[model samples]
Target chain A: MSERLLTVSSSPHARGKQTTKSIMTDVIIALLPATAVGFYVFGLKAVILVVTGIATCVLTELCCEKIMHRDVTIGDMSAALTGLLLALNVPVNCPWWVLMIGCVFAIVMVKQIFGGLGCNFANPALAARVLLVASWPSHMTGKAFIPVDAVVSATPLAIIKEGGDAIPSALQMFLGFDGVYGCIGEISAAALILGFIYLLYKKVISWRIPVTYVATVAVLSFCFGLSAYEVLIQVLAGGLMLGAIFMATDYVTSPATAKAQFIYAFGCGLMTVLIRQKGGYPEGVSFSILFMNFVTPLLDKYLRITKYGEVKK
Target chain B: MEIKKGTFKKGIHPSYNKHYTSSLPIEIMPSPKEVAIPMSMHTGAPATPVVEVGQYVHLGELIGQAAGYISANIHASVSGTVKAIEPRLMGNGSKVSCVVIENDFQDAPCENVEKYDPETVSPEDIVKIIQNAGIVGEGGATFPTSVKLSPGPDAKIDYVIINGAECEPYLTSDHALMREQAAKVAGGLHLAMKVFGLDKGYIGIEDNKPDAIEAFKALNDDSIIVYELETKYPQGSEKHLISAIAGREVPSGGLPAQAGCIVINAGTAAAIYDAVTEGKPLYERVVTVTGSGIKQPKVLLFRIGTNVNEIIEYCGGLTDDIAKVILGGPMMGPAVYDPNVPAGKGTSGILCLNRADAHIEDPSNCIRCAKCTEVCPMGLMPMYLGAFSQKRNFEKCDEYNALDCIECGCCAFTCPARRPLVAEIRVAKRGVQALRKKRG
Candidate 1:
């Protein structure tokens, strides 16, 4: 006679039709469109940044797990996503050292130190970007964004922050025509939008965080100084799309409840506007996501999803 | 056109993957030469064996009698000789006393014990007939139907909720039963409603099953209203269904009857109809034999105590790379190593998954995304419960409502980092539940 077994132990069953590998594979495919755009805009530098970021992120994860006596999880491909996201957040002109620091911070400090993957309270890439931004403001803000033709220019946010009247045109920003001089990663709006499209098509990221966060930032930024159309440009330009589609929507760090996610996205947009309008920083997607990440657990606690059969309060 | 209103706040839509065999009608599985009927199929007290070794018994003969009001009887699935009454393996890695019957193939007949005349039977008599027939909830929760149908001294049920939702993917036994045995289900519903003196019945089906909804709607009786629920995991859960149709909240730590409702599965209703109309006990049920790894997928009308391996072989055998052999639907079913355990009353589906489908990586720490909380039908914090479970803090796990988790698998399904949220939480739930019973 054979033995009976515990069936409902938890997910995932060893024999489920879907697996973590399949999901991660789907995510990688989704991220490819955006990475290709980065290559088109920044050429070889974008490829170097992505490769270096991935290597550093993976190595750091392995080292941390080794030190903690935990099994190596390089197979999960989460560290690779973190690396890719970190690279996307950094400037195209960011030095190798800056990218390495961001990778270490993202993989070890933000992810592994706080309990890897699902345990971390905030998105690793966003936290690392925020930290890198704070530690080396000059490198982060002073670097020139170079386009395909080697044309260098300041980002629209930088132009606005510097009190320059000649801000880049909405069409130029939409097409990523000029921001190439400010930072490497922020160069092409077209490339980032491609990534957004890929994610939307693959359903790797839902529309809630990106749509809500952008709308919130657009309305609030317009309320400050930029024209409504200019605010729209700001919403679409810079790291707003990158942060919304990838970082802010990090399943682990984001609020799980729909009500809470709506609030979390709004908070992300509000903070982005707050930082852009009044804070020392010229752009704010990274800091905005990090700040909102801190409140995600609390938001989840109070903003419980109304369950089936639960009496509404 | 207006969008259909959903009952719950948040849910994940997993790949249906039902096309493998959704259109197939249920086939009847041949009764095994010998049957092993487990005594503890239901949740409450396990029945005690009333028959001894070497005794002859006919099909539907009572083998195990209910030990309590919350328990149900066990019957012989085939006309056979009682070989032995001993501990046998159950689907969930547990062991229970099971009566082994060796079939004679002659199908030796026994004298008619007793039959409840449905036309002359009173409400109480119907309840007695149900109790005697050994009917239990067939929607994976094998709670005794008689007790659920019995309203308390002050309790009055205004609604008989027929659970046709079958929210768990890949399990279509209920769906098949609804489509094929609508008359029988309706008859059982009548019996249940008559007993409760309820005037109205609501059949909750996930919007995914438009055909099942249409089938019931075509039978349009004023008493039965078919409500199309949004296609969401755990939509068929009792509390979720109660909220969906009746707009009633079964208070935390309370039963559904507290809010004037008693939930019953569509399969259970059909079984009840069989018992009252045909004087048959609950010895057989429609079990969905499916999964991507199986050679052929089928919904087989299988008798209780038939070996699972035999049933799978009947369905064209497990494919070469079978990894998991689950006893129910993928969402909440348990994995079983043994293929010898017989299908019990609650066994509705047997899912055979291939190696590619079965590989699960180790879970990472909680990312605190709170997705688990959003999708939880019970409104419990799965992340915290999982954390507490990891910490072995059973008390905290209980406080977080770990027991309330129906193990719907929604949290795990939506977790991007692929954290084993429900797996860890279930451990804590079991730990806490054991402690509670110990304290009591």
Candidate 2:
């Protein structure tokens, strides 16, 4: 017994089974339904875009870590999750090179340059989508949506922005617009809800952010004098479910406490409604989430919960 | 009287690996041939050695005298001749002066040992007897129980709570004690309530231990109320247990007396009863020798100063792949490299973990997931405390109330990034203390 080597450390020799790799794996598993829906709606091009996005993001992460002399962390599956979220954020017909550019920008500029993984101040996928929309408007926006019949058309949000009655019905928006088009993941609200349920069930994310975000949108939209049908369409339409469930709830970019999370998500919902109603952009999810990501550190610093047994004055 | 069930908020439920020894009967191990009793087993000043080398001492004989008002007396666990008085390794990895003795196996009792009738003794005399017996909180804090019993005159302590929660994973000494010696535990509680001049006493047991609960409930003592607490890690924590049973929060930086409560461990209660009724000193305790690395898991009542190596050898020795040997429960127990370290007053369990269970992963950067904040029983944000401590920004750590942290390891255990949140916060707490000292 005296000859045997033993490890000595401080208290807590045991650890919980969850790891960064496992959490990333859970998020990846949760996104499968939306990815499958995207593939079914937009055919092989969606698959190609997703594959390209993942490969480029993963390769870029490897190169960046090597160049920075940091440990290779691609095994954590974070870069792959970002790649998948990026693919879902863009149109299915997005040029392969354009999707690749978005993927590299996400992994390199938004994630690795500021340090890595937890150090990134912005959601990589959302920031890259914003950059792409600004740089290549034609490739990213107008006539970018292609329905199954190969007809190029405006998305439901775009139709709503144009004050056109051709907007799809609420039910069509809830399922997917059969005759209309949107971003690959935003095409089906049902698929996004399925993914959200899986995430909640797996304890990957909490309900405070997503539930508060969507409810804020619905409540504020009605307060803005929109009809109940229009409010339902607004709740189920373009990127709202996807962004609220996936993007805004990103752990690295969101607030840390439940109170701060409610306030941050409320800010996102309020900004999204304001931008969609009055700002220059027709869609608001990406911009609102990215803007609120910058405020997360402040919210966390100020909105700390009262410590147990604190003596209140 | 109806039994009440209660719980505090925001504690994690780690897998309680109590099945190995929870059902096993407490077996008394034969006293070892030699023992090395440390003078610093209890918190506060170390006891002063009163015996020299070669002095013959009987069992229950006072070998070391309490040096200060806060220290505890040390007694000989076995009748033996003193071999040496030197520094020896202890379970906490520190070397303290020890009274090494070679047991003669004479089983002779000390002439000074005397018993008293509980009905005839005053509460203050009982407290004095407890102090003379060197009894401390046996749930591992080892704080001198006499200090708790004699609170400041201004303190208005109204509750006497016995902690039977035993919330730590893989340790069942308390459970076995409660199941096997329920009457002594109840008698101890009655004695404690008499000291406080209180009518009601409470025992807080986690709902997971229905057998221990049944044992206590079977007593049918009207003065003692058994509360079934939610089975959560750290439910045995003094502050949390007070919050759950007494419905009071110990003020930050204050003792349980500030909350009108006096919380003692179940083992400590039993020891108190023995000290008063049979004139026994606290020279031995029940320690659970368990975990995946041990060949056999058991609850053993052994001499206090016996080396962990002998205890493990009695438990059929370690398995072939044993990697870490913790001196207590996994959560708060210190991992010791030397198996020769003697069990002290606070050693509750000897947990031998295998290679797979002892593997520590390389921690990644914090993702700001806030899972640590969510599960922190103290309600302090551990993520920022860890970050600021890493950055060496003690001012930020102080501003964040890092001093309020209980070092429960809840944050570290639940972190997905495997960040050593508790370890970092401990550093921050020290830093904050130094900063306050400098300001003063």
Candidate 3:
């Protein structure tokens, strides 16, 4: 025993089975339902856009790390997740070149430029979606793309914004049935809910952010004089489910403590509702989440958890 | 006999690999050829050597005297001739003065050994007896039991809780003790209650050890309420256990006495019973020698001052790929570089790990998954503390209350990036303490 050289480090000689790579893999698994739904609705064009987006994001991450003389970390699957999320945020009929550009902006400008992964101040996918919406309005809007020979139509939120009553039925909006025009992943509330359930089951994400975000949106919509039916439509329409479940809950850009997370989620919901009701754009998930992402550090700093056994002042 | 299950919030459920020795009856190991008793096993000033070189010291004879108000006396574990009193390596990688003795193989008892009448023993007498017996906490903290028993008069102590919650992974010494000697453990709690002038007491045990719980329940001691706690890592932590059983939180930076509680380990309680009833000194304790790296896993009543290497050999030696040997449970145990370090009064488990089990993956960027904060029992944001500490920003660490961290390793254990969160926080804690000291 004396002759043997032992590895002596700090306490906790054991570690958990979950690693960064494993967690990313779980996230990727959770996104499969939404991706499949996107393919079903938009056909081969969606697949090509997704493949190009993933390839561009992964390659951008690898190239950035190499240029920065850092360890190549694409194996952690973070870049792949970023790419998938970015792809899902785009219109299904978006050109492969436009999707590639969005993936590069997500990985390089929003993510890697800020030291990558957890250091990113804004969620890469949301940031890229905002950039795409700003740069190529014709390609990024809900009315811009015709999905697989379907007639072009305004998204449910756009119809609501225009004070129109002839919107898609609740079931059509929930299931993203044929001719319901929207971004690839945000079209189907059912598919996003399925992915959210998988994430919850795997402990990949907690219920605090998504539950509070969507609940706030629903409650605020009712307070703003929308009828009960309209409130239900508002909750299920557009990217509310997609953004609340996947984007607003981005671990790196969200507050860590439960109390702080609630406040941040509420802020996101408030901003999202305000923008949808009064702003120029018909959608606000990307902007709302990006705004809350910038405010995350402040929330975490000010709303520190009441430490265990902390005496009341 | 219906026990209520208790738990603290925000703790993690690690894979408790206790099956290796949980069911094994404790077998007494043969005394080694020589014993090297470190003078500073307890958490205080080191004992001063009283026995000289070449002196023949009987078993349980006083070899080192408590030098301060918060130290424990040291006794010879075997009847032997003193070989040397010099600095030697300890399991935690510190060099402390040790009294080395060559065993004579003759079971000679010290002449001062005498039983006391528990029925007539005064509370002060009980404290003195515990001090003389050199009984410290056997729960790895090694705080002097006498000091804990003698909390200042101002403290409004109400409950005397016995910690039977062996929640650390790969450690079952307390479990074996509660199973085989439940009465002694109960008797020890009774004595502690008597000292505190309390009639009722509590014993908190993790629900994973149902047999141990049944052992105490079979005693039908209504005064001793045995709680079945959720089997979670660090459930046996003193503050958390106090919270779980007594429903009181020891205020931050305050002792358990502040919460009207005094928690003692089950092994410490049993030792108290033995010291009062049979006039036995705390020279031996049950140690769980088990891990994937060992050929045979067993619970053994090992003599203090025995070489850990010899104990490993007694357990059929190490497996071919044994890479690390830790002196306590894997969660908070320090891995030893020198396997020959003598087991001390606080040594509870000897966990040996194979190469695969011992390998630590290289850390990547912290994904800020908040898993650490979620699992932190202290409700601290360990990710921030770790990052601030790594960047040498001690003030931010202080502001975040890094000192409140119990160093239970929950953050590091559950970290997705394999970041050494606790290790960095430990450095920050030291830095904060030094800065405060300098300011003072």
Error of 3 at B422 (Å): 0.9
Q: Model 1 over residues B69-163: C-alpha lDDT tens digits?
A: 78889988888789999998888888999999999876554577566665566899888888999999999989899988886789978889889
CAPRI-style quality class for the chain A–B interface of candidate 2: high
Q: Return the TM-score for chain B, candidate 2.
A: 0.99
Worst 10 residues of 2 chain B by lDDT: B112-121
TM-score of 1: 0.86
Query: How many steric clashes does model 2 contain?
Result: 0
Question: What are the TM-scores, per candidate, against the unseen true structure?
Answer: 0.86, 0.99, 0.98
When 2 and 3 are scored with lDDT, the better candidate is 2
DockQ of each: 0.32, 0.82, 0.81
Best by lDDT: 2
Residue A99 C-alpha lDDT in model 1: 84
Which model scores highest in DockQ?
Answer: 2
Shift in Å, residue A247, candidate 2: 0.4
| Residue lDDT tens for model 2, B346-366 | 989999999999998989989
lDDT of 2 by residue, A39-153 (tens): 8888999999999888999999999999999999999999999999999999876899998999999988899999999999899999999999999888888677764465436
